[model samples]
Target chain A: MSDDLIGADGRKLTFDANQIRDLLPHRWPMLFVDRAYDVIPGKSGYGIKNVTVSEPYFAGHYPDQSIMPGVLIVEAMAQLTAVVYASAWKEEVADSDEVDTAGRVGYLGAIRQMKFNRLVVPGDQLILKAELGKAFGTLTPVTVQASVGNELVAKGSLTVTERGSGGGNGLQ
Target chain B: MSQSYDELLDQAQARASLNLRVKVLLVDSLGLEIQAELIGDDQPLFGRGLELDSLDTLEIVVMFEEHLSVTISDDDRAAFGSVNKLVDFVVAALGEIPRVEALA
Candidate 1:
């Protein structure tokens, strides 16, 4: 496949569902992001999620109104954050001969000051954006937002523990 | 002319107020279950005291930047020793109790 997805920094800027699958451990019903692009390792990333009526949550979310749950939008943003970190980690290990066979699994340390502006619905594509802040040890501070076109859907800051940091059943 | 006694008293009061603010900020930013007053002014922030880990340190860094308008770089790890140490660092950085408008 002649994939010219490299960005100005010579790092891969785009990832399709297949590429996303290789980085994230989430499977169907939990995997929220369909395409991730504009990924600047260790700094920022953007993602796209095409909302459809066929989503499992839509069946019981309203049963008639079909509004996407706000939490899921935040989840999509978190997944994009995972991409940002995982991509950076990949770059860090790229020059080494070591092969990392572990599937990336990140956990949310805390979801702080999240505000929802509008409800998402079928046919609306969620534009996910995440800006990574400073990282101390395994924890990184990230500001994330999800929007549908020009309308804002949700915005928040999250403390994300990097993949394989070993936090079992606890948020922090 | 040396500083007056009243001026020295005023400076001490200002430092104490900043210490309280920093303690309150630590509790609020870290989502600590305990009250701000419960935290001692000289209590060690990590290990044997508040038992804060690296994640909590990051939270404090963000909190200081947002609320105190002070940057806590890697070299400034010494300030994380205690609440008093953190307040002293802020006072030294800002050269005063951070003004109310600085809080975001």
Candidate 2:
């Protein structure tokens, strides 16, 4: 909600858990989306997740200390990509002949070349960004990078499939 | 269905306490940042208020895996929408392991 949120392109984006909940149906113990910023729907989006010690994984992780896992980093990135496409093309889907399918069907089709540059830990905030990668009919791929400050944490690519009226199987 | 939400919350909170304690032990035992309100129990760990962003999220994810050895599914990783929702989900997820194993 700041003037600066809009990059030079002027397309603005944002989301909260309530919004994410409506978009996706992963309940407690799942649903890894928090808030999104500067999302351009079909083109790109930025997602944010606040890391904390109050996570279940920490109890069994170390008992004494907790560190974030690498796999989750990439998962977070994928979730952000879904948000991007939803924001980008939701309206078009709604207006098209398949509005019903558009309601709950953004799928991450694939992920590639995942590399974690650094370790993630408690109290660290993760910012995931996605941009257009490649497109082929219903499937679109994206380039994603996660970072803290100037340091890169992870980088990879993800592909997503859109849903029209009949395709109601939303991803978790 | 599982033990209970309250039970899970307690479990997550206890671990969270340990993490904070460690943060204090390693970085700020003196509570210096306390004066500036650098971090708080309810402050937003990422974005404008605390300005955490991506790396922080990854750090938490790493911490969970390193300490718990439980992999957060793409479905459940670094989630924070409402403090209540986050704590609830984490506790439930952590507690579900016993049940999952019992089923096996």
Candidate 3:
């Protein structure tokens, strides 16, 4: 119900890596989302993940040739959805002190219609977008897409389960 | 032929087609191990029937929106209990079986 997170022009709420860390439970190599922007709280949002050669997976995924795994790209999209859901949860339970909202956790319950259009490599800044779908109890469906520059790299729908209460808001 | 009889025939044919499309969508989107044609119209979609879990149900909801241009709210969750039920919901929402050729 709160529009405080949304900007005046109907755009602009961006989250830095530090801010993202607070909203998501993922960290270290697993934390794929570096930054996010155009967050529309409880609805949809976009995020960025800068893939680099120094990434640990690059060393093993292919010593001869480096390529970001398709599953990781999907994970990035899921993380962005989590951030959107978490922001909405914060607004919904703003006054509730009993719930420890920090480090909210969720798991990828299902993935459907996933199609990888291109291989992501080092130095590619992946733009991830996730749109909220119908909520059935604690399970939330999200339509997600990932792109490098203007070219789409991946697209799919995912079901994410927020741990704790069965509220449709989000994790925690 | 009576006008009512003609209308009933058209309705029956439309329902038949919608049922086929729904089955295809479920198998394709959920990646069911069985063939789409093999799934019985009245068979349960979850648990022991198709072995689909709650997560699959969410995916199925998205498939309905994306493929069929139909919205299945949480309140309509029970409709997803079976393929026949889902097809009925879609038909009711759309007022007709959407032209599958157009969707392709």
Candidate 4:
């Protein structure tokens, strides 16, 4: 329960890409989340997505004019949720060195009440947040909200299942 | 093997938390600025009138992985065109499975 979580520069986890990869299971073009700040496992986490005209999706989304899509907003939320679960796993298993995410994936069970409050333009920075609504080992209930400052963009809740069972996260 | 729209929609919404979480992850992780809203449970979440576009769909494909923990096949494109369709797909895939989160 930290009000202000700091990063390497004592700034915050807001600008840590290396940490992002370690937590998330995504690659280029597909990966939308850029920085996750104010992260507190199993509680709440805040992240950002920077939309740009240079994105490949913009090429055909509408050559004349590029606009950020709505679905992507959902994806960003899911990723942040994964971090919450993953970080929780790390915290729980920190005592024992027995948990690896290699050769595995997290499955999305469902999304509920997804709404697009505004359009994410080429340069707008989307602020995504996740609050672990319900957590029980591997099966967690996640609630997400995406916004740009004070504006609420989208929100939903879904189930998550981490693959390749082993370690402390496994259900009994 | 086709289910009613109502059945499909219910299945989808009952499927996964990451489905919504990953979309949040990518947008913020990659530094993409975007916005999304809640379409009616009965509303169409795809195509004209909706904020989502073609590329937005592609990102959804990626979102499938980051959130659902499932790899969307090439054939899945059409199924996810509508939010209702995606929910149906999710319901069909992971809804039945007894999920217990485990480390890889």
Which candidate achieves the best TM-score against the true structure?
1
lDDT (0 to 1) per candidate: 0.82, 0.59, 0.81, 0.61
Off by over 4 Å in 3: A1-6, A10-12, A95-99, A102-104, A117-119, A166-172, B1-3, B33-37, B95-104
**DockQ, candidate 1, vs. native dimer:** 0.39
Comparison by lDDT, 2 against 4, better one: 4
Please tell me which model should have the higher DockQ, number 1 or number 4: 1
State which candidate, 2 or 4, has the greater DockQ. 4
Candidate 1 lDDT over residue span A18-38, tens digit each: 978777888899999998888
TM-scores, one per candidate: 0.82, 0.53, 0.79, 0.53
Best by lDDT: 1
Worst lDDT run of 10 residues, candidate 3 chain B, spans B95-104
lDDT of 3 by residue, A1-172 (tens): 1234456775446778998887887889899999888887778998999999999999988989999989999999999998888877776876874444444557887786599999999999999999987687678888899999899999988888777654343432
**Judged by DockQ cut-offs, is candidate 4 incorrect, acceptable, medium or high?**
incorrect
Q: In what order do the candidates fall by TM-score, top score first?
A: 1, 3, 4, 2
- Candidate 2 CAPRI grade: incorrect
Residue-level error in angstroms, candidate 2, position A10: 4.1
lDDT of 4 by residue, B1-104 (tens): 99999988765554443234433443443334553223333344454434454334444555565666655565666565554466557657776622322211
